[model samples]
Target: MKTYDEKHIKNVVLVGSAKSGKTTLAETMLFEAGLINRRGTVEDKSTISDYHEIEHERGNSVYATSLHTEWRDYKINLIDTPGLDDFIGEVASSIRVCDTAVMLLNAQYGVEVGTELLWDYIDRYQKPTIIAVNQLDSDKANFSQTIEEAKKFFGPAVTVMQYPLNAGLNFNCIIDLLKMTMYKFPAEGGKPEKLPIPDSEKGTADQLHNELVEKAAENDERLMELYFEKGNLDEDELREGLKIGMMKHQVFPVFCLAAKKDMGSGRLMGFIDNVAPSSVDMPAELLENGKEAPCDPKGPTRLFIFKTLVEPHLGKLSFFKVISGEVSVGQEFTNEKTSTVERLNQLFIADGKNRNAVDKLKAGDIGCTLKLKNSYTNHTLNFKGASGSIAPIKFPHPKVRVAIIARNKQDDEKLSEVLSEIHMEDPTIEVEYNRELKQVILHGQGELHLSLTKWRLENIYKMQVEFIKARIPYRETIQKAANSSYRHKKQSGGAGQFGEVFMKIEPYFDGMAPLKEFPVRDTETHELAWGGKLVFNNCIVGGVIDARFIPSILKGVMEKMHEGPLTGSYVRDIRVSVYDGKMHPVDSNDISFKIAGMMAFKEAFHQAEPQLLEPVYDVETTVPDEMMGDVMTELQSRRSIITGMDNRSGFQVIKSRTPLAELDKYFSVLRNISQGRAKVSIEFAEYAPVPGELQRKLTEEHQKELATESH
Candidate 1:
């Protein structure tokens, strides 16, 4: 393989909704460049991008695959990303490293929910994007409507460069506005013959051409002046103007394609090679220290690991892009994040499952190295003296959660190891062993994301696992004030344990009045690790209880707070005042005071109105207008409180606050109600009180479990 400099290397990521023909487009581009002997279809599971076994089983892509093609004078590295939002981690990482994004729009569906969902990520990075309207040969294809929807969602930056003369079932000819020519393809559809624009369509073609010219000229003052002087720009000038517009995100040129039939792919690739911004042309990458790293081959070597994969035979492949200088085989670099030295023993350009070994990779080129000791995804490798590392990719938080249990009892440790490996490969899948819940929980994007993880664990790791219901992290607190005293007197052999504690427990808030009955001597406010505050008031008078033993009393209160009387949940937002207590001079110690204080707090908690609090999430569900009512009904049925509603780009956004307990398998239910036309996002809002009946049932369940355990 030949090495290309920054100017000649273009890193592009293909992103769009599922069934938008992104994988098909990638396969067609490779075939057109003669990198592949024949094209592969998704139906046959032969495409280069959708190469995973799970993808084959699901008939869709789940992982982002990397492939490269050398066209004309440039090397276009393509990162084909999965379209489902569940796999959005792949798309986000790809977008972070790529210089350009090629978003495919399926003509039959126009702009879909997935398209709208992904546009947020693309717009966040402000990546130079190209819009490719694919599947024009489908019977239901509507090119004009798709373009209209794209403009509606993406704003006025959408610029049409080409449109099919006959979009549906016979999309063989396309009118190119930039060149003022027509491309006519044969029935077999490999290459096209250029011809003059037809006289009948000249008026529409000229009008669109003038609009395209004005759009391009708007990005540069020099191009605007030249266009006004000559009434038009030359081919090279137009390419230059469009490139400027792309870099500024002021223009998104649209093209037509039928990737399955191999029509218009050649022209799209030609445009990418000729007009798209290469890595060197893009803005310098931002570093952690607010500095920029220019793509200069002569600078110090730096590489950013964007993705990691573990194949069955191949141990680990860390895919990275050369950020500054060139890297060759056997070159050593320090992992900035881990402070470990790693040598690039072998470098290869990845093409799906296949890899072509290369001696050197220059700046802006994407390649993978094998067997790095400490480096992983989002880590940066730099020379020893380099100061700052590249800014890491921020993956989205997990929206769905499930408790995982190993079916075989002996495989518990192995299950943990497998989950760790999975998280290393995909950071979006988070694993936590919650001590309070006593369950190993797996958090991910959605149900599909977690089920796929289960599939991998069972098939790849050969471990049987089951996903159970994850318990909610509920909290317990008091709603009123109550006073109680407990006497702990026991004699175990030599020393007798005798201690008595008198305390008052009251509901706590940010600013509350102090106790007026007892003279306040000293006050201590403690912040609980779980949530809320534990205000401990030492109101004892005249050293009735020693100052040293105050901590012991507070510790006892905390012991009861940790395992609340009801449901064994953490207690928060409460104040306990140790006003008076009696201690046996010899027998009273830390343990005795702790017991007495714990018993008093528990007795007072039972007398006071104890309330159960569950986590609430702010959920935003984007639903189509036709299915808005159904989605709204579904949310209301789950004890959700409607917060607000918004209208955006032909979709309705329903915002609500729902309890965490009511949101189990919520996405699955939403998908079923909307027929997969709705998208939802959830975030922790605040903790709210649970209903009386539900609280009673939960407390009873906890007591029964404790009773059974006592046996």
Candidate 2:
């Protein structure tokens, strides 16, 4: 395939909900462009985009695949992305690099939760977009109804550019409203036959044409005046106005297609070539030197790594978009983030499993470079002496966590390395060691996402891992004030250890209530007494306790602060006061004082009100109204408290607070309840005290486990 410069290149990402035929549409486009002689079907596992083993087994796209096709003298670099919410990271990365987004909607399903989510992301990035109503040949497809749904969810900017000639299985042709002509295709393709609109459909076609003209005119004041004065617009004027409006995101042209039948695929391609913005039409690259540099191939090199893939055999492949200047093989660029220079070797354009070598890559072109020393997704590459780095794309933090352990000891070391490489490829995925639980956790958007990563670990990296339930990070704290004393005495050999400590434990509730001595005034006014401070006073005026032992007692108290009496977990928000103590001159030592401090703290903590704190999460769920009741009931069962609910367009937005532990398996439950119509986002909210009985049980279990582990 011939390469195109920035002016002729169009980077578009195909995005939408699951099973929306986004991959099929990409396949059809490739076929129509003559990139592939015979079109590969999704079910047969022969399609170029869905090439992964898991994708073929599931018959859906599992990751984003970049494919380039030449059509109408333009190079369309299409990134076909997975629609499932689990793999949204791929969609996000694709959106970050693409100049435009083409959202594919299943004609039968119309707009869906994932479609809305992708729309929001596009809006957030302020990228121009086009909506393609696909699967028109499906039995339940309805073009008009789908258009209405699109307009309702995406606003009135969704103007129909083409109207289907027929619905369902008879859908073989479409009327181009802008051109005011109808094109029909034969059962087997050569080229679509252009014909005048049929008498019966001419009236509807004319109405659609008028709507398109009016929408286009509204984008420009002069055009609107001319349209109102002449009751029409010239074809050239209309096209120019619509193009400008689309670039500004004031208008979104909707086209219909049956990707499976390859109908309207050529027309869709033509529209993209004519309407989509080229690299120059899009925004200029913001260089690291705090300057808005034009997309000039002759300028200094500046590329952004938007995606990374780690293949066990092939090593790490870093996919980047050249924002400024040109990059060639054997040339080195500095990674501004890490201050490391990496050489570009074997520059290649990715098309699923195939990589076509290219001698040089220009600005606005997406290509891959292998075996970079310190390059990963979101890293900005530039020439030396660049003042600042380009801002990285922000992705949502992973809210869901799953504990994963190597299935066998043999895979442990390999699992660690594989997980690190995977995390590097997708920054949204996080792997961390939970010190308290003694487990390695893999966190992501949902269960399926983590599961897929595990599958890749085994199949792609040859590392076996087991997914286990994650443990909640619980904390312990005191509820009230209590005082206790402990004496440590031991006599064995010539020298013995002896220490005595009198300590007081109290709840430290800052900004909650007045201190015991302050009453309603500020604690500063009553310096002698305060609620939050841990006071250590030397009251051994008569030499009852040795002064040398005071520091040891405080050290012992500090060590006891880590594990509370209520649970074998870190304790917080408590004050410990060491008032007085006694010690023998020769026997007094740090070890004896430390033991006394631990005993006194345990007794005092029990005397005070002890409680366990569990992590809470703020959750937002978007679901259809019909499924609201079910979702609410499930949340209630999980001990969630509904904070608010609002109607957002046709969907219900539910905001609630749920314990993190309760939401561990929420992704699967939500899928089952909403039938995959719901999308949820969650973040850490705060920590709240757990109930008394549950806290007691958890504390006992934790203590027993710790004892067993120590033994």
Candidate 3:
């Protein structure tokens, strides 16, 4: 392949729902461009895009694959992304670098949930798109209905550029509305023969032709005037007007295709090469520091890594796109994120699993290099003195989380090491060890997202892990003020120990004052490390217990706070004051005072009316109207406090606050209730007291577990 400048480079990403013919469309496109001898099917798994073993096993794409095809002296970089919601990170990162998006719609099922979900990302990136209704030859194909649904969901900007001439079982031809011509493909379906529209289809084609011309003309004032005068747009004028409209998102031309038969693919590919915006036409790269980095070959060299792969034979492949200037083999650069220097020794352009060695990758071009140290996804590598780094892609936060335990206790250390490597491969999966909960939690976009993670952990790292419910971190606090006294007396040897301490425990809040009855003149109150306050009032004017042992008394109180008496949970929001005590001269050491303080605090905490505080999540669920009632009812049954409700994008959004304990496996239950037509987002809200009945059960469970362990 020959080199092409930024002007002739077109970066386009292929996206759609699962089983939507995206992989087949890519295979047909490769065959049409003469890049491959035979088209590969998802069944046999010989296609370039679905090259991974997991993908071949599942018969769908699991990761984004980058490939390029040269047509009409233009290099088109096509990124085929996975269709599963679990791999949305793959879709998001691919869309970040592409100049244009080509979204495919399965004609059998129009306006699917996946289409709506991916469309949100496309809109977020503001990428100009071209929609193709594929698999028109399927028995259940409905092109007109699909178009109507597209217009309903995507707006009127979606206008037809091509339509099936004879759809269904005999779908062999497509009418190109822009050129006003008919393309008839052979029975085997490779290259189509161009022909004039037949007499029977002329009326339908004329109406669509006028719609296409007017849609194109409306974007450009001069083109509109010319269209009104000449009654039609010339070929160059039509192309120019469509380009402007596409860049402004005012036009989203819809086409028809039979990807399996390779029908109508050539026309789609031709339009992409000629009409899609190039790298030079894309908007400037906005830096984190509010600076713009345009595609200039003469500027400083900079590149960003969007994907990382570790092939069995090849050590590591760092896939990157050049943002400014040019980068070549043996070029050393500093990573703006890590401040580490790395050399681009061997550069290669990727075509699925195959790689072609290239000496350099220019500005606005995508390529990969071998063996980069300290450079990871969303990181920018630039020349030594470069000031700013390009903004990174914003991936969605993890929605599903599980507490993972090592089935074999010996694999605990290895489990963390393996998860770290997997996180490098797919950053969307998060692994955290919560010390308070004493569980290693794994989080991802959905169950399948984290299931694949467990599969890889076991298959690749040979570790057995089990996922269970994550424990909620509940806290224990008091409501009232109370006082207690404890005395320690030990006589075993020559130096016997004896000490006594009297302390008061009270609920503490910001700006809370000392006890009104015993208001002291000098009370040195210190805020607790986690929460609450500790007021050390020296009310003993005669130095009754001695000032040296006061520190020891406070230490004992803190140790008890670590394990509250109610449920063994951490205690917070309380004030402890060691007001007075009696100490023997010889036995009043730190040890005697500490023991006395611990006993006194425990007694007071029991009388203070302690309560358990549970974490609450601010949840937002979007469900179709048909399923909204059931979803709301289910939430209400789970003790949900509905905060707000509204309609958005053809779905009802219900916002509520629900206890974290009540939300275990709630995602799966919600899917079952909505039949997978709903989505939920949750975040941590303030902690509230657990219900009285539930708190009693929790305390009993904790006590039983402790008793069982002791036995």
User: In terms of lDDT, which candidate is strongest?
Assistant: 1
Off by over 4 Å in 3: 165-169, 197-211, 218-232, 384-387, 405-411, 479-483, 486-559, 574-601, 623-648, 651-656, 668-678, 708-711
lDDT per model vs. reference: 0.91, 0.82, 0.84
User: Please, what are the lDDT tens digits per residue for candidate 3 over residues 284-391?
Assistant: 888989898888878888898988776655667888999888888898998888888999888888889888898877788999988897787888898744667889
- The pairs that clash in candidate 2 are 288-388
Q: Give the per-residue lDDT of model 1 (tens digit) for 415-441.
A: 998899889888999999999999999
Which residue runs does candidate 2 get wrong by more than 4 Å?
187-190, 221-231, 287-290, 384-387, 410-414, 491-497, 512-554, 583-592
For candidate 2, the C-alpha RMSD (Å) to the true structure equals: 3.8
- Between candidates 1 and 2, the one scoring higher on lDDT is 1
Candidate 3 CA-lDDT value? 0.84
Estimate, for each residue in 102-154, the C-alpha lDDT of model 2 and write its tens digit. 88889998888767667767987778888999988889998888888888888
Sum up the clashes in candidate 2: 1
Candidate rank order under TM-score: 1, 2, 3
Question: Clashing pairs in model 1?
Answer: none
